[model samples]
Every structure is written in structure tokens, then in C-alpha cells.
Target: MDLDALVARRRLGWERLRVLSRQRHLDGAQADELLDGYQRVATDLSTVRSAAPDPSLVTHLSGLLAGARLRSAGTRTFSWDMVGRFFVEDFPAALYRLRWWWILTALANVVVGLALGVWLYHHPVVENTLLSSVEVQQLVQTDFESYYSEHAASSFATLVWINNAWVAAQCIVFGVLGLPVIYVLWQNISNVAVIGSLMHQHGRADVFWGMLSPHGLLELTAIFVAAGVGLRLFWSWVAPGPRTRLSSLAHEGRTAAGVSLGLVVVLLISGLIEAFVTPSPLPTWARVGIGVLALLLFLVYVFTLGRSAVRRGITGDVDESLEAHVAPTAG
Candidate 1:
């Protein structure tokens, strides 16, 4: 009821809280004092809001309370420093560490795609069974080429990015199953093989490569990385080595999450190339060159920066400070 008297009574406590809240470090006594001050001031503010509801007083106390609350509980504010470390250290390190998994995956997919493409090309009967003559003709003549240019570049890029990101996410999320990741890769590679064979059958091999190469190189690599990371996650638990299975899975799971985020950007670049560079009138060489450059830069970033980070003991997992403490185990 008596707002001014209450303010007079609680002013020192509020001021102490303000000072404590702004402090960079506090000893145990000061921490206790800060907590005590915060509770008293909160009560003061509540009483004022209900009895007097003085605008200025309420505003001042509210601000003080907010700061003290944040100070006491601590807040994880955004930091460009964390972001920089993530890209420069965490992401590349994870990519580098898991390079074998994805490299093998990419190689296997390529072998499958090329093998199936060759098989289908040599076997005209198989293509006929998959698609009627009319459908195959339509696909080779217009549908395949038009697919890239039919939508506006920006909208198409967005759609491609979203779709590819979802696929990458799925690979990481379903990695534990192992079989699902393989199934996804098989489905993706088979479709590409079928299309490539059909395009080659129609004597549009040049056109097919020209349209797909500009984006497919990086796009498919990102997918392979995701699939590899997923398989690694599954294997972590299956064969945890010295660590407990749960511990192994958690470590890999965190790394997998980071890889998933990094792949979003990777896929975005590929989507841009697919929507803009692929359909553009630039010579096929120039477009493919850009795609090659992008892929090379990514590889260099992983092998160079990522390898260095790994050497420095970064595993793409959260910082040790953020990780939960685990029981010590003998090697």
C-alpha cells in the first residue's frame, strides 16, 4: 500500500542486487548475498505491482530482477566466438574424422550408379519394363531438362534446399537402424542410374551430364556425408570399442548432430547451383567447373582445417565444459 516506504526499505537490497548482477565474478558469500537480495527485491516488486502498481518503480524493479535472474541462473547468450569455433574447429573436425565412412559411401554409390547405368544402357528390355516407350521418350526429350527450369530460380532453390536438407536429416536420424540408411542410398542411386541409362539410350548423355554435374557433384556428396555419418552413429553403438555402448552412441550422436547442421549449408550451395547454374546458358564446362571448385574447397576445408582440429583433439562434439561428466574407464 505504502509504495514509497516500501521502496525506501528495499532500495538498498535492490541496489546491492544490481551491483551483484553486473559483477563478473563473485565469491561464495557474495553469491549468497546476491541470491538473498534477488528474493527480497522480487517480493518488493510483487507487492508494489499489486498494491501501488507505480509504473516507474515497477519498471525499475523489473529490470533489476531480470538482470539478477539471468546472472544467478546464467544464460547461454549467442556468441560469434562459439560460431566461429564451430565452423573452424568442430564441423571440419567431425567431417575429417568421419571422412572414411562418407568416402566409402560415395564410392559405393558411384560404383552402383555407374554399374546399373551401364547395365540398363546395354539392356533395352529392362528400360522398357520400367517405363513404356512413350514415357521414356517424354522423359529424355523434355521432362528431365524442363524439371530444372520449370520453377523460378529462387523458389526452386528453396525447395531443393529444403528437400535435400530433409534427406540429410533423415539419414542422420535413421542412422541407428543401419538398414534404413542403406535403403535410402540404394533408392537414390538406383533412380539416378535408371535416369542416366534412359538419357544415354536417347543419345542425350551430354545433356544429362551437363544438367546434373553442375549440382549433383556437391549435392550427392552432401547426401553421402549424411549417410556416412548415420552409419557411423549406428556402428558406434554396435561396436563401441572400449567405451560403453551408451557412451559411444552419445559421443557419435552429438557429432552427427553437428554434421547435420553443417550439411544444411553444404546442401544450400548445391541447391543454388542446381537452380541457377545448372539451367543457365553458361557453357557446360564453366558450370561444371564451378561445381568442381565448390567440391574441392569443401574437401580441402575438411582435410586441412578439419584434420588440424582433430589433431588438436577436437572431435566435433560439444566442448568438454558442456559435456556431462562420465566415469573414468581403463583403456
Candidate 2:
């Protein structure tokens, strides 16, 4: 009604609005509440005074509304580096904590081999372990040519690749949990011991070269790399340097896990070639060549490739993300 009362109301309104308006962006609820409050106040002011509303105040309010709209427009965008930071910070640390399983597994690795070896040494007639009757039957009944002919050559090859990868993945992943690591070591020990005993008995030490030379190089190296990681895990807890067992396991497990997964992938690739290709009835020279190729693949992955991948991942958020995702996939 009075000029003084009118100005005071306008001043109070502007003051509160200013407090909320300071932000560059306004949320929907806040902006709506503010706009409604100002609209009512403006109506009252227009009645009390002939003067128009201040343009500067209006511009400030408008700017906040515009900024809020801008914020909403780009809602779907996200930082690519987010996942990189997670794997680098979270997954590796998880692997580190899991190292103890690796450590325990390494110790038990030799048990199966020795058991198989000793048994084969005494029982000259036994050609392989018949621990499971079903396994023996499956091996005996398997008709390679019939199975191979049933699927298209390429289809069979692809299927074998996938199966090998799955098996390798299972071995490497479960090994970290310690179950596969023990089982693998047991299998290897039993199997290798038999081979050793057979070689010794038959005095055909060189036969190992022919029987194992081809895909064996890659397959065996992959197993060892996995075992090495397992051993590293064991040593972490056993020695633990100065730290507690848990603390040691946490740190080493991380380093060991990347290596373990890499090993699995390597084994998968090797197994695929051995199963689906490698000429099935590979000659001695071809087997040796494949074995050499497997050795080279192992060397490249362990020393040059795996190191670089992990390094790029941990170096920075961006590089690690790229390395973790794009590089391994492309390779």
C-alpha cells in the first residue's frame, strides 16, 4: 500500500531469491518453487508501484534455469575411465587377497605326479590311470573320425576352440580358489609320473619329445605360469616377508591373478590348435614345430605382452581402461 512497505517487500523477495539464484543450475522442484514465489511477488509489486521488474534479477534467474536445462540435456554421458579405475583399484586388489590359495596349491602340485609315477613304475602293464571307470570308458569308446566328420570342418574347429577356452578359463579361475590348483597339480603329478615311469621302463625317454612336443609346450607352460602364480601366493603367506599372512596375500594375489588369467587364455588357444588342427596325425617334425611355436607364444605373453597390459592399465585411468579393454580384445 505505502511506498516504504512496497520497497521492503520487494527487497525481502529479492534477497531470498538471490540466495537460491547464486547457483548456476537449479533443480526442477527448487526452480519451480522459486518461479512461483517470484511470480506472486511480482504481481503484488506491480499493484503497489508503476515501475517494471528489474531486468538484472530476471536475467540471473533465467540463467540458472538455462543451466539446469543444459545439465539435463547431457544426462547420458559418462566417464570412460570409470571402469579402468575400478579394475585397477578393485579387481587387482581382490586377486592380491586371494594369493594364499595359490601358495597352498603349489605345495600339493607334485602329489599326483609322484603317486602316478610310483604306481606305473611297479605295474609295468598299466598304460594310464583308471581312477574313474567312466573316464576310461569315454576314452576307449570315443571315435575321433566319426565325431569329426559329423560336424563341418570349420564348425568343429570353432567348437573345439570355444570348448578349450572354456576349460582353460575354468582351470585358471578355479585354481585361484585353490580347488583347481590342487586338482591340476594332482593331475599333472599323476600324469607326468606315469610318463616318467613309462619312459624309464621302456627306455624310450625320447618318446616324450614326440608325444608331448607339439601343443605340449604351450599347454605345459600355461600350466606352469598358473602354478607359478599359485606358488607366489603360497610364498606370500608362508614367508609374508614382515607383513601378516593376510596382508601379504592381499598384495601378491593381485600380481598373480592377471598372470593367471593370461595363462588360461594361452592354454585355450594352444588346446584349440592341438585338438582341432595340428593335422591330427601330425608327423614328428610337425609336432616339434608346433611345440616350438607354443614356447614362443608363452615367452611373448609372459615377458612382453602381459607386463605391458598391466602397466598400461595401472599407469593412468585412461590408459589402463584402454589397455584393459581394447588392447587385449584386439590382440
Off by over 4 Å in 2: 1-122, 125-180, 192-211, 242-247, 280-282, 304-331
Query: Ten residues in a row with the worst lDDT in model 2?
Result: 322-331
Residue-by-residue lDDT tens digits, candidate 2, 1-331: 3655655656666565555555556788877756665555445434433443445544443444443333333343457685454444433433334334433444455454556677787886576544344543343344322444466656665675565455444555554455565565566666566556755655554544555566666665556556656555666677888777876676555555555554445666766665554535667787678779767755553344334444554411122212111101111
For candidate 1, give the lDDT of residue 247: 82
Clashes of each: 0, 13
Which candidate's lDDT is highest?
Answer: 1
Positional deviation of residue 242's Cα in model 2 after best superposition, in angstroms: 4.6
Give lDDT per model, in order: 0.91, 0.52
Tell me how far the alpha carbon of residue 74 in candidate 1 is from the true structure, in angstroms, after superposition: 2.4
* Total clashing pairs in model 1: 0
- Point out where model 1 deviates above 4 Å: 1-73, 327-331
Question: lDDT tens digits, residues 11-76, model 1?
Answer: 788888999999999999999998898778777776776677778987788788778877887868
